[model samples]
Target: MKKMMITALSVVMAFSLAACGTKSAPDSAAPQTGGATPAPDKKEVTLKVGATAAPHAEILNSIKAKLKEQGVNLEVKEFTDYVQPNVQVFEKQLDANFFQHTPYLEQFNKDKSMNLVTVTGVHIEPFGGYSQKIKKIDELKDGATVAIPSDPSNGGRALALLEKNNLIKLKEGVGVKGTVRDVLENKKNLKFKELEAAMLPRTLGEVDLALINTNYALEAKLVPTKDALFIESNDSPYVNILVSRPDNKDSEAMQKLAKALTSEDVKKFIDEKYKGAVVPAFK
Candidate 1:
């Protein structure tokens, strides 16, 4: 009876030791729910904008840090041609674009049947005429080839500039709306070559004179203030603008970008960097 009792006691002790030897699950293995819940981090908004290489991208790059501080990350995509920027914005691939003026935007909207509105006016890249073949405007010979932007608005702008310089005369009151067909008087009997705005800079040697936008001229290393045979006045009506769809035009991020673009810092940067090549449209 004593041996049986001892055997029972031994059995109970062995069971206890076996249980202890089998390690239990760790506390870390359980899902924690009792402690305070951690707050989620605020997400940063990304604002993608398309721009021309020179002043547009350069200007946008200047204010990146300021936009970032406001929880908006600015991504500037550089474009060589004018059409894709507007196309990308209209297709919702980009948040906005900053290369064209109000007139061009209006014409683009009308032509494409797309409604991209201007957020704010940033600066005026005065349209100018450049030539590698001539040193002066008067040096352009009769029947000289003059290359201009193919688009209606800019073609008109270039024609108007030519008219303003007395190289040609458009129909009365045609003004900036005139096309090559409106040239009523051609004192030089100049031939008109309409090319893409981006290509004009490269055609300097090919054409007697290529009317180039300031942005392209700058990209090609041509200094507008010094190199342009003739340039539009600073008060010209063409003001390059920030453009977006009506839906997102007034968003917080877009507004912040617009504000930063027209800020005093940007004004100073334009003044010091572009000299008289680019003029700030904002007061």
Candidate 2:
């Protein structure tokens, strides 16, 4: 019995010595490039995702499973507001973000001189017109008050959408970014008021027609396919993007995420899910 007890103690001490100060395989939940090695069969990505709570996060949810198949462990982080996500990305707290379009992203970079770039276009959310007071565009009376996003980019978006619906006409080469001042013609004789993008949807009842951004409009229970009087074109270059630091624009995990979000499966998902409210921009 004394010999057996001594042998058991020897085995336990050997195991303890092996574990002390000995690092196991690298965490499969994060990247370890200094002294640690990647796990043999798994790739770890402490990828941070910054996005809106609904569709952006909802879209990410659909791709999480597909991304995992490529051995990338993604952490999809949700942001309720728009500005913080970009700041988080610039601060190196996030791996990639998906919430804004090319024009907005360009504006963000130009405004802050941050080095953010899009990996790929994921979805195009249409800028739309909606109203509870008026049933449809044709129902809008002459001299009716219309509210639109006051910001440059989205105000231009609203104008383009208005132009597309033949409610207004723009000067040649005015482009989709044209504003209320750029309206070479306004046939409907409607009055225009510029309000912040986030406020337009909530002010719907006060105006005959209100141009609400897709995301906010959706939050207000407005469905582009049914509720919107008009929606932007499907290929709206303003399509929201999946973005990362310029340095990791082509990283393996980033590539996997970009591809997964734009994959055929996702395309079908958006088509069937948003019902034309959200258009998959990638062909």
Compare the candidates by TM-score and give the number of the best one.
Answer: 1
Off by over 4 Å in 2: 1-43, 187-189
Model 1 residue 225 lDDT?
Answer: 94
Error of 1 at 210 (Å): 1.0
- Candidate 1: how many backbone clashes? 0
Instruction: Report the CA-based lDDT of candidate 1 relative to the real structure.
Output: 0.94
RMSD, each candidate, Å? 4.5, 8.6
Stretches of candidate 1 above 4 Å error? 1-41
**Tens digits of per-residue lDDT for model 1 on 147-248?**
999999999999999999999999999899999999999989999999999999889889999999999999999999999999999999999999999999
lDDT tens digits by residue: candidate 2, 45-145: 65789988657888898887777777887888887566789999888889889988888888778888888988998888988888888776788888889
The estimated TM-scores of all candidates read 0.87, 0.79
Best by lDDT: 1
